[model samples]
Target: MKVKSAATQVHREQPLVLGYKVDIARQESVKAMYDSLVEVFNARLDSLINNTAQMEPYKPFLESDPDTYWRTWEVNIQGLFNMARTFFPMLSEQSLQVVYGEQGLWASCVNPGAIKIKITAGALEAVRNVLPDRLAIAGDTIAWLASDRKEWLGGRYISCPWDMEELVAKKDEIAKEDALKLRLVV
Candidate 1:
């Protein structure tokens, strides 16, 4: 749906996109796409963002399908890893964008009180969260993050709702401490 959504956006002239579209979940398709990108437009790739994820089969553990879990892992974990590995060599230090969306938004949405309506039962119910980040917050944050102003945040996990100004103020701590970057620690 990401490619389709990108196509729709381009058609609507809503979100300006200046690159070719490819689904990362498909290894061949993405490989071909990036291969072409390297051959044809290698010089134009200033940034590469990996927002790939598949949180499907969002049902309770008992009801969850194993296929869904596999697909989700394929796209969310393996695909993301592959894209990053494949594109790492193509990146230029002058200016490159690397964003990893933490799925914190949707995770939050399953929780009660985060939104007006929320999932109240089953696998998704247990996945309840405080509240996911807003769509605009993520979108706007990404836009701002892509700009030169936030270039220092080159390799970090960017949560959508975190205040940019607040982050900027804490840039020193972030860069030095790796404050907002994703980690396994609780």
Candidate 2:
């Protein structure tokens, strides 16, 4: 349960897995971040997942530099890529079930305003296309189509107490996906 900057390496002796806070503002930083993470978890981890809310706000420089935008994209988008590729095999049904418990916070389109919505939505779409089913996805907010259809990676979408049941239902859906996706193996 240790949280560290993306640049840091995971500590091998720590009993709990490591979580890196990525800054999606620079491309090189993203590469450096994942490279370091991969190095640590290559053989040491039993399972791997990410808490997307850990991504920091988009910096003003992110818009100014095309390279930076793509870098942010890599961190937000490719970060998932690296995580899945690096740790997909280690994830199993039991491991996936408890991996994300109480560790995530749902993000709202209003939390960081409209810009985050666009970026997060774009990244989410990209991951959905390439992501393998073996890993579990946990997130704070559930994105829905205009028809109220939930996205593939389900989570709670609303903030009020009345929505708790809906959130629980969505959580169940995600858990099922986690199991189905990993069905090929144990």
Candidate 3:
């Protein structure tokens, strides 16, 4: 219901916006979405933000249902992988435009720092004890990322709590250290 309401609101704001229910964990579903998108936009996509995730109810691992625990991994990891793999061609097509000096793709995994949403309000009530960050922190960060302003951050993980100006200042250092990527630390 929340998803539908959000979609309706976006469609109201932008008449061209199209919404479809998809199970990202399924390859066929992802393909259908890709097909629909290709048909609508004539095989052109400027940007793709893969933001599908799932969280099982907060519980101890030993007490958690095995299926439910794995489901979160399926949606969070496999779903994101499926979306990225399926959309790579269209995304690459957009990148090709860079040959002509046009702005290209800027993709990243955004961690919208602990904002209070439906799930947070319910399943994550423990967060209620802590002050949640404003929605604008994530919204503004994503808005900046959608623009051509920060291509260097592509293929990186970005936290909404990080200051963009500070991030930019340390871009070289970040690249040198290959930071912001998932890696095992000693």
Query: Each model's C-alpha lDDT?
Result: 0.57, 0.40, 0.76
Off by over 4 Å in 3: 1-15, 96-106, 121-124
TM-score of 2: 0.33
Enumerate residue pairs that collide in model 3: none
lDDT measured at residue 122 in model 1 versus the true structure, 0 to 100: 25
Q: If scored against the real structure, what TM-score would every candidate get?
A: 0.63, 0.33, 0.78
Judging by TM-score against the true structure, name the best candidate: 3
Q: How many residue pairs clash in each candidate?
A: 5, 2, 0
Cα deviation of 75, candidate 3, in Å: 0.8
Q: Cα lDDT for residue 97, model 1? A: 50
lDDT of 3 at 69: 77
Per-residue CA lDDT of model 1 for 1-186, tens digit only, reads 464687687785444444657667777777887777766764456555675455564556798798877877888777877787677556543234543343111111111122213222223554555444445566566556555435456446556666668878987887888654555766
Give the alpha carbon lDDT tens digit for every residue of 78-154 in model 3: 99889878987887776831111243645566899877665554364666557468878987887677766465676
Give the total clashing residue pairs for model 3. Answer: 0
Estimate, for each residue in 27-75, the C-alpha lDDT of model 2 and write its tens digit.
4554566577557756333323343433333346535657655565766
> Distance (Å) between predicted and true CA of 10, model 3?
16
